[model samples]
Target: MTTITRILILMLIAVVSPIGAQDFQGIATYKTHRDFDIKMDSTKMNDAMQKQMMEMMKKQFQKTYLLTFDRSSSVYKQEIELSKPQVGGGFQVSFGSSGSDVFYKNVKHKTYVDQKETMGKKFLIKDSIAPIQWQLQSDTKHIGEYICFKATYTKQVPKVNLNFNSKPNIGDENEEEKEPEMEERIITAWYTPQIPVSNGPAKYQGLPGLILEIHDGKLTVICSKIVINPEEKVGIEVPTKGKEVSQTEYDDIMENKTKEMMERYAPSRGSKDGAIQISIGG
Candidate 1:
């Protein structure tokens, strides 16, 4: 490294005051970008329409979020945007994607309480950060000013929906659909020891350093900026506004609610390709 570059890094370090082995609090801004691909028989729609739909879905998932953290507690939530809802295409189905909930985590206590207000009902999901068991590798890359190392892991998640007036599966209203079979997904993360905190964009942590970038192949979540101990004190407060319930209990509640909506809407009538297929608790 050149002497001038080393001096520049030192100056930058002094300005940011990166967290080390102690209690620290700050805010991190992240921008998440995702690509959406619908698997439908192309015979129904032309190539232009398909491309336009894909682009719209991609923009819907793209969002910015803020994560505030201390030594133990951290809260992650998405930034609000002013935009008109996408309409006219019919099929108003919600899929399994990243949410805009205030995810509060207590790392030292190994507990988390997320606050979510969905469909006029509030939920507080108190649970542990399900273990990921990441395999740390020697690969490294520079993300902005931070030197980050890569780690990968895999886990099973519930089957997701991308219903674009695609199927006539009455099974959606059936009880069996509630027990969605798990599908394994691979996750890649890049962390930097420069910011010595076990924190990341979403529910990812447990690494030796702070994760600057994370991806699950389909979606990419990366940090846009890191402000360490800014002029304003970062309030790392635990959210206690929603009705308390365990993670499993909350899932059951959502499933029951979704089933109720499916039945009410009469999914059998949703045969038209452009008709709205309502998905409750989406």
Candidate 2:
């Protein structure tokens, strides 16, 4: 059967289902993995050092997150874990502070509030949820015990320059630098009607059912486990501890910060660079 037909059936089932307590909550565990390729100056980094860097990057990007949701609202955050310090060549590799941010979404109101921390400053990013025009596909699959249907959406995102060569080109200083071009990216999601909740990990929502898996660029988020109406009820609270800013303002700040960081770490002309450079692409 087509996904749209299944969705209609699920909606009918939900309408006729018995109404219990007003408080209905669920907790979903999601594991995320991102693939990255690191290009470094071979002279500064040997085979062993490169392998170690790759391993560290893998560990850094492989993370688990928990989504606590009700009928109208949800909160998504990373599950923290303690690990031994990773240091190489007098530099320490650490996870981004944004990982600890709390992302709260209200599907009923089409709003989102994200608590973000960057450069020792806190910001509350409040904005309307950007709607995704998903095209439901006829393909179906199984995620654990749940049957999932495929849906896809295309978006334009800033293109990331993955050219990690630190060397300067001749006459490159005279050329005017252009803004990063936008590229089309397809996001694929697998959602199950069995759960009957319009929620997902991170900032993804608005689907007919709970999103069990998502493929966006190099990152993949998959639901590991789900508990419905657990013994402990989930409470989602809006974050209010940061300076308020719109999502676009936050993006501008981050983009400038990234440019500053790149300039700071960029190799100086005619200098012996011993630092390791790692680039994580989305």
Candidate 3:
């Protein structure tokens, strides 16, 4: 065929293809898991005790989330589990924040509302996605059936605390405050242009195409299944039945609540009352 004939055929295909990525709607299910590198001094507990603790931590970190998105907006939330009876009520530690967060994002508008539930209290956190300067690399890989590109960025993150014995004073105005230590966290994401829209799990977005996998060293969320333009369209709604708060305000609320819990249980620290306490990270 002549060169002119090939050019005309390409133009015709473009006219027939879908014009907008947002027009295609689907749900992507992701399964998340975390890794813990803990050096437990080795002398404090025997090998058997350490193994048991690891098993419990694994159960707590494994979670599943579903992201339902159309061309412009998407809603991502966790799959809740049925309530089960606990064997023993004691100190339990989770790798991530102890909250079930529901994120609603409009990709075109660049806005989001996070419906966060912490300690049975609801918070509607309205905020925009933070602009991340990702350094796009030439490396390409496939996440599922779609081909994805690589990007990386670094941010300063607060050091996580899972202390079960911290005692914090409530409403103490004269108490001197100490700044919490911060560390640099590197985030990497893989996105596919084949999917078209810019969306991902959690607070990640602004990529050329939809993000298929993302990781922040400790935890990773990978797309396990994707259904495109199903028979029934998933409803994307902003959560309203929660106390309205900005992202900063929500963090403050969580911090204060955590302090209250630590002080409430401070007296039980190291007490040999035949109670069980399990902690994962140092």
Best by TM-score: 2
The order by descending lDDT is: 2, 1, 3
Cα-based lDDT for every prediction: 0.73, 0.79, 0.73
Instruction: Choose the strongest candidate by lDDT.
Output: 2
Query: What is the model-wide C-alpha lDDT for candidate 2?
Result: 0.79
Estimated TM-score per prediction? Answer: 0.79, 0.88, 0.80
TM-score of the candidate numbered 1? 0.79
TM-score of 3: 0.80
lDDT, candidate 3, equals 0.73
CA error at residue 91 for candidate 2, angstroms: 4.5
Residue pairs clashing in model 1 are none
Q: Model 1 segments beyond 4 Å from truth? A: 1-21, 41-48, 85-100, 158-166, 171-181, 266-282
Task: Give the lDDT of residue 181 in candidate 3.
Answer: 88
The per-residue C-alpha lDDT of model 2 at residue 104 equals 95
